[model samples]
Target: SQQGEEDPQALSIQEGENATMNCSYKTSINNLQWYRQNSGRGLVHLILIRSNEREKHSGRLRVTLDTSKKSSSLLITASRAADTASYFCATDTTQGGSEKLVFGKGTKLTVNP
Candidate 1:
């Protein structure tokens, strides 16, 4: 499957703690993107790293990509209650002339203050 699947359907943490999630895919991809969703709203793009890249960081969020292993991980350091949301990893597969993104089921993170 080209779709990415994230481990740990849900996570709970206290404020100022760290949260980590892992994702695994079954196909080759051009790039991987991580997104965050609040409640029932649409997803917001957090970061995107190409296949040629290994690791990328943005603010308190860090992402690591391993194309050879077809896996990736997302880490949030010093998590806050405001960071409680659903996180998803999406893969962009456009080799077949179909440019589409397949999203994972997502990991629901709950931050307790």
Candidate 2:
């Protein structure tokens, strides 16, 4: 089954603007995390919000989780060209006894100078 899906497949913005991304998932999750990927590189963990938590912030990143809706949103403040990358939301799920992080398709963000 699909774990997570993100909306607005792609976005373009100017530097200093704010970028918002949303993710929707199915089933219960232990924790949700957001990551950023620069083109052909690997993903870098941004923030993680647990099932008990409603919102979290890290530097220029803000994340909100709504368990009732099985949805999460990530907001990036003062976007820069360096922030232009693919953002993804992942969910932590346990199967059998181990936990794993399942990632969504991701939203591609382009910040133009």
Q: Write the per-residue lDDT of candidate 2 for residues 1-113, one digit (tens) a residue.
A: 56889887999999999999999999899999999999999999999999999999899999999999999999999999999999999999997798988999999999999
Clashes in model 2: which pairs? Answer: none
lDDT of candidate 2?
Answer: 0.95
What overall lDDT goes with each candidate model?
A: 0.95, 0.95
lDDT by residue (tens digit), candidate 1, 1-113 = 44899988999999999999999998989999999999999999999999999999999999999999999999999999999999999999885798889999999999999
Which sections of candidate 2 miss by over 4 Å?
none
| Model 1, position 48: C-alpha lDDT score | 97
Give every collision pair in model 1: none
Q: Return the lDDT, model 1, position 39.
A: 97
lDDT of 2 at 76: 95
Please tell me which predicted candidate would have the highest TM-score against the true structure.
2
